[model samples]
Target chain A: MDNLVFERTKGLTKKEFSYCPGCTHGIIHRLVAEVLEELNVLDTAVGVASVGCSVINYEYFDCDMQQAAHGRAPAVATGIKRVNPENTVFTYQGDGDLAAIGTAEIIHAAHRNENISVMFVNNAIFGMTGGQMAPTTLPGQKTTTSQNGRDPYVVGMPIRMSEVLGQIPGAYYVERVSVHNPKHIIKAKKAIKKAFQNQIDGKGFSLVEFISTCPINWRMTPNDSLKWVEDSMIPYYPLGVVKDGDKND
Target chain B: MAKVLMKGNEAMALAAIKGGVDAFFGYPITPQNEIPEYLSRELPKLGKVFVQAESEVAAINMVYGAGGAGARVLTSSSSPGIALKQEGITYMAGSQIPGVIINVMRGGPGLGGIQPSQADYYQVTRGGGNGDYNCIVLAPENVQEAFDLVKESFDLADYYRNPVMIAADGLIGQMMAPVDIDKETPKLDLPEKDWATTGMKNRRTKENKDVDPNIIVSLSLVDTVLEEMNLVLQKKYTHMRENQQRYELINIEDAEIVIVAYGTSSRICRSAMEILKEEGIKVGMIRPITLWPFPEKAFAEIPESVKGLLTVEMSMGQMIDDVKISNNGKLPVGFYGRCGGVIPEPEEIVNAVKDFLGGLNG
Candidate 1:
């Protein structure tokens, strides 16, 4: 962790972090910054942020992050990435932002095979908006709005964005991982690194959906939240490469 | 008050350039196509950035990118075309990015027709995009306001750091008018942006670091944090509701009826009101220049003095609802209009106004 300390982020003083201690977005953000530091892509990289909790990600990542509305990170990322093709572009989006409001945008970007890597965080609830049922919300998970758990009969089943996006052309790589455990955290980091490398290599629309935890929103301790992700979120959203280049369904 | 001949769309583009905008990202749409044509030639010549984006999505996203970078930027499109831009618009609101978007509205409900129509009234004024965010929608009555608002919009956007929309109909884009901005374009060399990703290595980073750096962003997925963000926006919007209304009131005092109207319809309604004034019909008009801030209090006040009300628009009955809500049931309010390029004559409006008066008088 000492070697991984990003000098570019040295100026950032940790004001009491608002995020729950083990909530994975911090971990993912750390990993993204660490990789960028190692690759010296910090200055050349432009990040697009979607709606939801990640909106403030601009404050954390020591990169030129542009704020995009809802699911529009993909489209904005496309704009910066395509215009400055030499610059590496990525988007940090959450389930509701990517899977719900930005569904069409990310799907189209994947279809166009826009040279952008999407760092998708799936906490299975609209954690930023009082825990409403998200597009990736498990079928029976109780959220603030989905008081009776998400009723598939009323709200429909949670969407599998990785699988759905894998069908598009130019979607070079699509993987799903969890950040609920140290082992899972390492796997998530590797997947994120590969996605960034894919963009660096000019491969298009790579994504890594990190199954993260939302302890405060879930009304659980950070530890229990990680366990909830391991116990409940994974069964519905199994972590694995949904589609790699030339890989099967 | 003076008359000058200019194409509506071209005037709108000139207005943006005159406003000292830093960039124009656009794709072509009919009736409004002249804007892109003018920007393609003029924006770069003015030393502003102009990008003909790959699609409407890309065009709007380009605005998002530039706005995110804290540059004064904008994009333009028609109804069917603008629907494609909703996602980007929604994101702009959520991100609290300041920018301008122009909608030269055409027929819809599904690309229903391309001819001039007011069908997009509800779409533009009542949150055409998804989500709960309300964009400040400005409805221009003629080519002049269309141009003037483009300049005014940039200021409003920067002042509030929220997206400001100058929503006009196809008629406004197709029609010609004389416009004069007393203010000259500022002589200052373009001010540098603190957030724009201009690829210039000399710029200071957002964190005030001497070395170049990229910005980091993540929209909140944490409930408490998102709640705080939304509350901050709510306060901004409340301020807008109090201070953002721009409207005109004509002969509202001592009138039996007030016609609530905006955009092109308001212009036509003004003419109709003049004719009715000659005929001794006691009618007044409320022209809402800023439709989103919606001169509601002004409209509601009129109901106390006027006996009846009527709404003039190009849509089936979009602004009518707003008029009714503003009336607060203190008096009866009715609607009149044509859609999809069939302009309703003064006679039709006269008849509707007379009937509403008649119903109240009976």
Candidate 2:
């Protein structure tokens, strides 16, 4: 008889993901689901799905969910956590949703030290709206709107959200990680789990930024995209814990 | 429970607490600051949630979250702030969540003034947010009515599973009057919020099987699916129109000219009606308590002796469109108004009514 070793986490429903091929949102979603399940909070987790490709994540997350307006996920999560302090609350937001239109909301949510976790997926492009330039878009990166490559002088350099959010005193934990390789994936999952655990321990705001890949938007094969993230993206958005309230304490 | 003098903003705040509000999230704006102030101090003591959000947009979205999570929530703002809230309002309406919003009217085309004006009449009644939707809009004339309607608005919101708005002018927000906070109003038989996103832990179906997790969302990407949702919303609006039309008719039995007004304008019109009665000019008034239902049914009660209608408003001729539509061209309709934070006096409405009658006879 074969020994059963691994199975799908019940934290996620059986619904097929709508993400494009080679996109890491599926991996990230699974990691979050597995984390919630391992923590035994899947039954009480309330996820806020923000605008972008993850806008329909409510269909996949096997937990009570709320889909918020563009860039309003943090506000929505704040509301949920305030009313149900015992329940786990988190927001899944893409770069455009978190770094651009929803800047004020995310900043204030962290400033208030809201006891919630955030999964910020930064792929350097707007995937849902068809590969538009994003606030996290790298300089010299070519996007639909940046036909001639991004000009840092005109559009400004990419924002380092982990750096900005890590500086917030209320933010209990902040980390930047990737899923381009198995080793990084393991590290990424560990960070994501700790973010949720921080909320469980009633620490404060926690966010984990994933250097995810969008092969379709990047105009590359899945393998090529992973290679690019390893070589180019990691150098710019280096992986590591930016802040840890536990370490500070 | 005895009547106590209170500012309009404070009275509404107290009434929300009595209405069983579980949370309030709001931003500070002129003429409505007292509301958030009172709640921020009192909600914490009561173990209720109160948040002073970073902006009006965030506050309204917080209202959406709390409402979706099976809590009675409220948010308050003035004119420009309400404009900022329209985005979240549309989302809440589409998601079919229950929440209360209070808009203390201020002058505006673009931050026109901070003083009282009924300029948001069109925005409030016409579904300020995008989409084919309507929010039940209640216009209260005084502090007592403001309290009563706000308290009742929570029930209306939950009963309809939609947002309800209390539209009051800045005069009402700043003024003080006696209010019986504990006054009884009929409670609605609201349905259970099984759809709320409390969790999926112990929820079970009739067959004793586990239920699926609840999702509060408004996105229907397909055209056909969206159309079906629109039809359902239309049906709800129809029911509201049939059952929720509310108005107060004064001296309409034998009047030659009837006036249409609401909120603070209605108070001025009532005074004008008294002045016109003393002059023997025979004027009547129709005060719309619910603005979205538009009180068109009240027009049918306009006596045949009424030869014309005059709409008096704090804004420049905004509500006159509704007045004309309700009148249906059976009688001539005229308009009188002020704007840019100006309040029309009773004398102006009296003159407008006399002119309307003269124009009809001419």
Candidate 3:
């Protein structure tokens, strides 16, 4: 009857997303869900939701979930993966939750080469806290915290987590991808799939960093936010595979 | 099983194994390092998980994850490390996850010392973590009691779906004594942990056929929802208070003075009672085993002949507040303490009891 060309992924629950208008989090969530479903790991997947805009992601993923304290999702994921080795475990974290307060946790998780996946969303601002400056917030970008535009001398430069984690010997696969347009959206899904597949194949500590947009906090229209991500964010955080364990082997 | 001489930290480690711990996560801290060392060597042999986390903060969060995943998890640290873990501890409590934590106390306002101290009485009995939550704290007076309580803590944690703590002092962690590792602990009729996040593949309910994914979370953005959750937690705490009060009375019958103490201080009080008895003075003790529940019923058992109460501790009288509250001003209360890793002798406690009684008489 109907063409059946498109439908919702089974990895997602019936709960509707509550992201602000023009936020790319909904799109990223769809890509992750699609990848989990395509890989047939939805039922066995355990997602650790961190503090931030995505803290309530437990309601969106149709899989077992745990809500971790601020900046502790990596540690939580490590625990889940270590005990339930056969289960697929991953953490969903925003920049402030991963790069700032949880730096030690994420670094140590990588150092241990824990067999888990990580989905890091970088919108360059603390979306849930009403546009505070994030560790990933670009220098010269204005936010509630950096009213005079970011001064690298005053605070610090934006941290590129994918590149930082890629250098770690324990990290098996690391990549940075963006979701600004349809073409890049397809590429982002590919990287996300590989990250999950690496874990399915027993690879250690895979991570996919998504360059997402926060239109509400960016003080720009949804379309302008996408343009900003391409024009501003991409020049600083280039997209592509940062490391591949298979190639090293 | 036959008794074997075991160091306190090692004995507790073995007891945790015997208690059916599924995983151990911990960090290196003074006075409690032996615990993680023992588990790091032993757990792998038993095909159980053991992780030396980056810090006490990570270790406790790991405990939260494993416990949420339906594994019986344990972690251990000393005073300063335990302070670092308060955040994760509160999260576990709020999530109603089951975990066992061992706090082998050392002295501290900050980095106090490596020696024995009961200074953590307030931190353990009162909530060290945020929120309206209380961990079931067990204070053991000796190595054997420490072993037994540690083994039972897992069961208690699971039965209540709450965190449990073994509030041992440094003496309990470093001292050596004989312990029957196979000693039987009372079994609890625990409910099945169907809420654990073990996956959603086979989980099903008869009515729904397809079960919803189990979510382990403590975040309730709605104020009303959080208040309701707090009420539920309060009910659980009240039930714990009703059923879990434990204490031991020694020579309390027909005694003219009673002593309140727990852990290493209680052991000293026992020797003090014997010394007072030898001097023809009747002295007794109410040794509290459950610090949070605080054994108020034991106060009711105080002999009418008792003139006053003396609470002895290794710190500057942290447990005196509980003793006063339990005594309810029926008898005058006095405190005797030696702080900064100092241990009081039996003769000192004997003198303190006499002085307390003299004040009451005057």
Candidate 4:
């Protein structure tokens, strides 16, 4: 039996990772890299690293990558794709990058029905900046600033970007996946690959939001972090494609 | 070639599209809103790209993405809107991407006025964004130059691998002038087919198969490496300074006073120079066509016998700083201009010249 031996995908360099123990970004990144390798699009794949935790994504991916200011990767991707229209371009973003600062960019990029893909890594918190409350943070989740847990009265409900963005005609494929375990990780890889293929096939505005975990700032064990995502996060950000494919759940 | 009256702002946008710019990202601001609007309609017809970015910052970054892909991309706004774009401009400069930005100068420190002003002379010529980066700045005196310079701005941007600014005043942008769009020019086919994200993939150096997904970005955790990269950037800039200097001279021989100005204010200064000459006051005009590699040699043509220099502008006193620095404190530089949408009349500029001469000759 070929070992389901997990490893960093090929496009990712062998550089030592600085992510916290059990941080899911590494897993998500590997999955994306593996998809690139599988789809035979690695050399043609251009990624835009957005602001926030994923800003340093230029270091993670080996293919042509460019960093954009917070929340502006979608616009950057639009620029590159419009210019070349032949390259496979996608943006790697986090909730803070996509939801907070980049709300307008992603929305308009999708609205324009630009031929590109977006990988949204949502850990419900700002991981690199020491875990601030993110747009996708659970209603009652606690963080560095939200010490007493998120106040629903002030902060309001978390944003469901995949669903909201999926409403646009240009958003051809939109899905929410998680990597809390091997099973979910495999599923995420498939979803990310499909999103990229949609672009390659001339479909537009594809996105896959990964419900990831940040163990260090969650102040919980790796196992507890996974449990928290299942127990707490799911109720808020229900997974599945909002508008694409036969399955919509 | 046929000529038709066209607003400077409209001609600038038209020239960009006709010059092979396919992507335009912009946010509406005074004197330049027509640019984005024109692109919105023109790009769709040409199968080009048009995006009304969320803010000035996002608009400029979008240009960075397209430009990096080797597409001729452009963005336009007034002073305040351009201020928002400064951050993205820094990134574009650092990445050595070629792009064009048009700033229709307006009065300001804050929401100063939409009226034509050249207060941003320093902002446009010097480093507007944080970094040791500079953009090639072009100053067009009339509506026709605004159109012609937009195309030149794109070419120079690629040549220098830096952002280029067409710095014009609200007056120039709003004014109507005849232009010949049919003037034959070289084919602008600079797409790096091997690299530009263009769907046409026949040109990339590396095969698009079975390689790692690469990212195009400006962030770096390695500070030492970043410093080394900046050093390379500085070298490129030095080469650009030597290659891209542009300017014009008018009646400098035996002239005791030289009037230095650019953009809209320079046009008014031209009128003032003509008035002074008619009155038997020996004065010459020196216009800095390219503001960033500011025509320093124009001043070199000014002999030591020249008593002083006057700097006129729509801004209170921005470009005077450049004049003083370029002179190395060798000459007495006097300045006068209006701000907050108040344009300085030619007579006002003449009065300032007269006052400066009295101080220098006495």
Candidate 1's docking class is incorrect
- Give the alpha carbon lDDT tens digit for every residue of B1-362 in model 4: 88978888888988897677868989888778888887898898988888887778778888988887878889999999988889889888887888999999888889988898888887887756887888888899987778788876777777667899988888988888898876544344454434344332233346543333333455567899889888888897788788778888877788888888777777888888888988888888788888888777777889766888888877778788778878888888887877888877888888888888998878
Docking class of 4: medium
Candidate 2 ranges with C-alpha deviation above 4 Å = B202-209
- Give the winner by TM-score: 3 or 4: 3
Candidate that would win on lDDT: 2
lDDT by residue (tens digit), candidate 1, A124-203: 88987788878788887889888988899998999988989887766889999987778887888788888888788876
Clashing pairs in 2: none
TM-score of 3: 0.99
Native contacts recovered by model 4: 0.70
Rank order (by DockQ, best first): 2, 3, 4, 1
Model 1 TM-score on a 0 to 1 scale: 0.69
Off by over 4 Å in 1: A1-35, A38-44, A49-60, A67-74, A78-88, A91-249, B1-4, B181-218, B300-305
Error of 3 at B256 (Å): 1.4
Worst 10 residues of 4 chain A by lDDT: A240-249
| Index of the highest-DockQ prediction | 2
- Model 3 CA deviation exceeding 4 Å by range: B205-208
lDDT of each: 0.78, 0.93, 0.92, 0.82
Model 4 ranges with Cα > 4 A deviation: A1-16, A167-170, A245-249, B182-215
Summing lDDT over every window of 10 consecutive residues in candidate 2 chain B, give the lowest-scoring window: B201-210
The per-residue C-alpha lDDT of model 4 at residue A75 equals 84
Give the winner by lDDT: 1 or 2.
Answer: 2
